[model samples]
Structures are given as C-alpha cells and as structure tokens.
Target: MPKLTKYQRRITWSTGIGFILERMDAMFMSLALASIIITLHISKAQGGLLPAITAIGSIFGGIGFGALADRYGRVKTLCWTIIIYAIGTAGMGLTNSFWMLCLFRIIIGVGNSGEYGIAITMLSEAFSKKYLGRLSAAAGVCGQVGSIVASLLSAFILPRFGWHVLFFIGIIPVVLAWFIRFHLPESKEFTENRDAIEKDPNRDFSHWTELFATPAECFLTIRIMIMFMIHIAGYNGLISWLPSIAQERMNISVAGSSLWMIATIIGMSLGIMCFGIVQDHLGSRLAYGIWLLAAAASVFLLIIAQNKLEFLIGGGIVGFCSDGMYSGYGTIVSKLYPTEIRATANNTIMSIAKSVGSFSTVLIGFLMDHFSLMAVILFLSGIYLVSFVIMLSIKELKHENKAPVTTTENAEKVAQ
Candidate 1:
C-alpha cells in the first residue's frame, strides 16, 4: 500500500531491464538453434550442445563476477556484466564459423550469468522484508516479459531476417548499461559497508570465510543450497520435456506447440504473483509447502488432460504451482547473509544449483528409459514433496532492525 522508496524503484527498474535483456538473448539461442544447425552445417549432437556450453560459461561467470561485485562495487560491476552480455550477443550474430558461434555464446553466458545474483542482491538490500518477495517476483516477471517478447519477435524475425539477425537484436540491451552506470545508486547497505571499510583500512571482508565462520550460518547456507538444487531439478525436468510431450501427444505442429508454451508462461506469471503475496503474508515455510504441494498436484493434471484445450489450461496451473515459490528465494537467500557478502551468497547458490539442475536432462532420460514418459513426469512431482519436507527443517532467520525473516514465531503471525 505504501509507495516504493527511491532505492526500490531504481533496483526494480534496472534489474527488470537486465532480466529482460539477459533472458531475451538466452531465448534467442533456442529459437535460432534450427537455423544455426543448418547454416553451420553441424551435427544434431552439436546443436544440442550449444546451450550446454552457454550454461557452462555461466557457472564461471557467476563465481567470477559475484566476487567482483563484492570486492569492487555492485553498480560498476553490473555495467561491466551488461557490456559483456551485449558484446557476446552481438558477436554471435557476426560470426561465420561454428567455433566462433560457440565462442560468442560462451561470452554471452559469462555475461548474463552474473545478472541474477548481483541484481537480486541489490533489490533485496533496497527494500524491506515485507516487499522483498513481491519485488523479487516483479523482477522475474520482467524476465517472463522478455521471454514472451523474444518468443513473439523470434517468430516474426527468424523467418524474415534469419537467425543471425536475431542475435544482433539481442545486443540492444547494451544501451541499458549506459542508464544504469549514470543513474543507479549503490545499495545503501553496500555504501555504508564501504564507508566502514574506509574508516578501518585493514579489516578483512572475505565472504566465503564469513559464510562458514559460524555454525548457524553454515547450516542455513547448506540448507538453502540443497533446497535450490531440488527445486530447480524438478522445474527444469518437467518444463524442458513439455514441448516434446505436447507435440507428440497433441500431434501438433511447431506453431501449435507455441500455444502450450505461452499457456505455461502465463501460468508462470500468475503463479509468481500469487506466491510472492502469499509468502509475504504466510511466511516462507508454509507458503512454499502449499505451492510445492499444489505443483505436485498440478503435474498429475497433465496426465488426465485429453485434449489441447485441457492441456493448455493445466499448463498454466502447473506453471503457477511449480515456479511461484521461486519468488521467495531472492528475499530468503539475502536475508540469511549480510550485505558484506550478500551477492556472493546469492551467486554461489544460484551457480551451483543451475549446474546441478542440468542433470535433470539425464534424470528424465534415465527415467523414461525405465518407465513411461507419463510415469516419469509423475515421479518428478515427488521432487517437490521432498523439497517441502526439507523446508520444514529450514527455519526462518529473523533479525532485529526489520531484516527479512525466513520463518514464523506463532500461528497468529502466519500472515504478518
């Protein structure tokens, strides 16, 4: 009900821009893969490996830039990340050789990899605990917007202008870096920490050590890491398989398949919005449990749907239940750590989780080999169940001075 402060306003806008740009370029690779395989004269295997390479680049980028953001500065490092993302994206368009394409994709991966942890760290620090989840959802919703626009544009652009031109369009976010560099203020927490550092010139500020210096912090850190791993694994497994499942089961063409994706993304938007508001009201544990349980139930809905119309409707609900909980993590993760290493904590967990989650491809493949596709998908739902159980042990980290809290103290405070 209250107006967002100046800091919250800037972070939401800037991070939203970064997500839009970063995700659009990432989505472009998906749309361009077909044309790229043909133009580069590559094997089917190579086409599949392209995105994997980009992901690998992201792991390194996240660690490298995450630390830099802590050591150097958030705003300055963010501009650098944008520049790298833009250059990598544009270079992908200009390249003629297959290796060059791989190179540029890695570059793009490296650049975009740093976006989430750093930007979300900025957002988490800028706002109060009350608005953190909603703001986090808003940032992700911006990414969804970018993905939708990219989907639409790629449909229009690739057929008319070719895949290379699509990559050129990805570079448009480079302009955003200019605005961020000039207009965005450093996070207040980081700014004050910097001043403190200046006043005491010899103090050590190594985040990796501080993260484990205390048992409670270490326990919380590990718990969140495991939770992310399971959450992402289940999400990636189901969503990645949905296209093929829809195309085969519905017997639809590529364009028709887009309907399923669009439906799911719409669901994702609604789910994100719902989860944020609910979590802020209900506290993280209860909110996550309900959403994850709903996600599992929604997955079974996929099995019962007999037609495209039913499938589309189910897809929306599934998207909502499955990913809505994601809105909580930005607030939750940052809350567990201090400003001294907040970016470090977020990026570290994100990088590791994404890398581990990629194994969902292998998991699905392994499962389908042993069982039916429907059965495998249904089994994947149990992942959320497992995550929910783990979450029970992950208590909320409440601090004084109005820092974000991850758990509740009493039943009456459920909606506090």
Candidate 2:
C-alpha cells in the first residue's frame, strides 16, 4: 500500500468524526425515547414515530443532499449537513410538545441522512482502494462507538439530568464542524473531477441522467438497493423493537435491556471491524454473503433461546453478523459508481432502501403487537434469507479486471 498523505489522513479523521457525530445524534433519541414519552405524556405507539420521522427525513435528505454533494462538492455539503443536525439536536431540548419534538427530529433526520453519505464518500475518496474497506469499516465502528456513548449517557445521565440534557450535549458535534470546514480539504478525487469538467467546454452540468444509462448499472443499483432495504428492515426494525421484546417476552428490566443492547453494540463494532478486514482480504460480496447467512442463522437461534443469558448471547451473534455488513454497503456503492454521481447514487439507493425499511418498522410494530417477539424475529430472519439470495446473485464488481477508473469513478472511489 502507498503511504497516505497528511491531507488524506486529515480527511479520514474528519470524516470519521463527522460520521460518529451524525450517528450519535441519530441514536440518542432511540435510547432516550422512554424518557421523552414520559416527560411529554405520550403513548408508546406515538413514541415509535420518532424513528419513523427520522427515517422519513433521512429518505429525503439522503437523495437531496447526496445530489447536492455531487453538484456543489462533498466538503461544502457536509458543512451544511453538520450545522443543520446540530441545531436540530439542540432544538430538541427546547421543544415541549410531542409534535414539536417530532418536527425537530425530522430536521435532524435530514441532516443525519446527508451527513452519512457525504462523510462515507469523503473518506472513501481520500483513502486508497486497498484501504477502503477497512477505512469504511472504521468509520462505521466510530458510529457504533457514538451509539455506545449515547447508551452510556442514557444509562447514567438521563436519570439525573433529564433527557433534554442529551440533546444539549449533542451540540458538541456542531462545534467540531468548524474544525472540519477549515481543516478538511476537498477530496483529491473531487478536485480532479472538477478540473476535468472545467477543461471540457461541452460538459453539461444541467442534468444527471448517466446514473441509470446502462442496463448493467441499473441492475446493480436495483440489486444493491433491495439488499439495503431488506438488511435495514431486518436489522433496524428488529433492534428498534428489542427493548419492548426484552421487557415483555424475557421479563427483563429497562436497565437490563439497555445493558443487553450495549453488548449488541459492542458485538456490532467488532463485527464491522472483522467484516472490513475480510472484505479487504476475501472480497466484499463473499464477505457480505457469509455475514448475512450467519446473521440469518443467528436470528433464528435467538428466537429459540429460552433464558436471558442465551438470548443475550444470540443477540450479540446476530449483531455481529447483521449490523457488521453495513460498512460494506458504503464501500461497495462507492466502488460501483463514478465520482460525479457517486454521492447521488449512494444517497438515492440508500434512501430508497431506508424508506422501505422505515415503512417496514411500522409493519414490524404491528406484527409484534399481534404475534410473539420470536415470531417477529423469525419473520425478519426470513427477510434476510431473501437478502442473502439477492447478494449472492449480484455480480461482484471487485473481481472485474482493470476496471475503468474515470474522474467521477475516482471520486466515488475516494468517498468509499
């Protein structure tokens, strides 16, 4: 591997920090949902909408900001996304009504969506292809770390200071944005693409139709998007409902559930790191398929675990396999597209998947209300089986010989 320049190092560090902050803010609400519901005197069903709202915002934010990133530049778009999420998070503290809080969360979602794609793109662009998998995995691990921190804060801080304080504390990420804006340079990939466009007098900037111009490109896009949808649906939908599942099915306390979740997050962090290493060595598609299959098996085993210890062990395994593959999605997408439409492609495909997954959350909640927790887990696991098939059937891009690397292609590669 070639030595990374100082600029590349800074971009990676900044992008990882930005990704962590984005994930932390996004998850803080999930950890604190009970507190928010209690403080506002809202029903449990209404409380569920918080994530749905964020998902909805993410659907829009991912596509809109992703396209904007491709057009305006990744660094500039990232700056705006960070600022938006920071203000929205802090604003969560000020809102008293449930509806108002939802509005703030939606705004936060918009920022959260954009932040993810741009940061992933930025980091991927800065690092070499050999390091892309591990770097992207590291970025995801940082996000999981942020979630773990939020979990710890929820466990310790919320009981004494109230949930509002969490949002107020989220303001710290916004402060980090200044450092990002001044310190992080435009990705080398982005600069090259910009220069190419400048040099070409006939280049059209008015529209972006090349993203779906080819059948193979369109097929790959659809397959990946479907994979994301099923992955998120099973992962997010199941995890989001795990607390309630633990409380009702396992007869565990909220604190116990939180600890169990902490264990899962730790497992997820390890899984992501392991997946990255495997992707770098074995390849993304194979690594992803193996993880998904393991995850599916884990979920099925989890459903049959009779005791708390057994359940926790199963959950951890599921976390390791299921959530671990998320980092690979960004890396794969970055490799699949060119720099000019990289963010747009990443955001659009992910957003569509997220939208489907978000809607599935509602369905999962309905299923849980009618069926047992085990039943829901089984259902989600079945969905992962479909994802496994999709993944297995798709063409593995990494195996192709001397793939054409355009300016846009390089930009997408850098951002991965």
Show where candidate 1 strays beyond 4 Å: 5-7, 31-48, 94-102, 160-162, 362-371, 397-416
Worst 10 residues of 2 by lDDT: 400-409
Residues 1-416 of candidate 1: C-alpha lDDT, one tens digit per residue: 48877767777788888778765764566556656867888764566456556667777888778878887888888888787887888888788888888788788778887777888888877777677778888888887778677767776787788888888877666686557656577877888887776687555454554555557667777778777877767666655556556766888654455445777877888888888887777677777888878887888878889998898898888888887876577678876666767787888777666666655645664565567777766667887777778788876533322543322121124555
> What overall lDDT goes with each candidate model?
0.72, 0.76
Error of 2 at 388 (Å): 1.1
Clashing pairs in 1: 396-406, 396-407
- What is the per-residue lDDT of model 2 for residues 198-269, given as tens digits with 9 covering 90 to 100? 788756341234555556666777898898888778766756777667766799765667677787888889
lDDT of 1 at 67: 78
For model 2 the local lDDT of residue 11 reads 76
lDDT of 1 at 318: 87
For each candidate, give its TM-score against the true structure: 0.86, 0.91
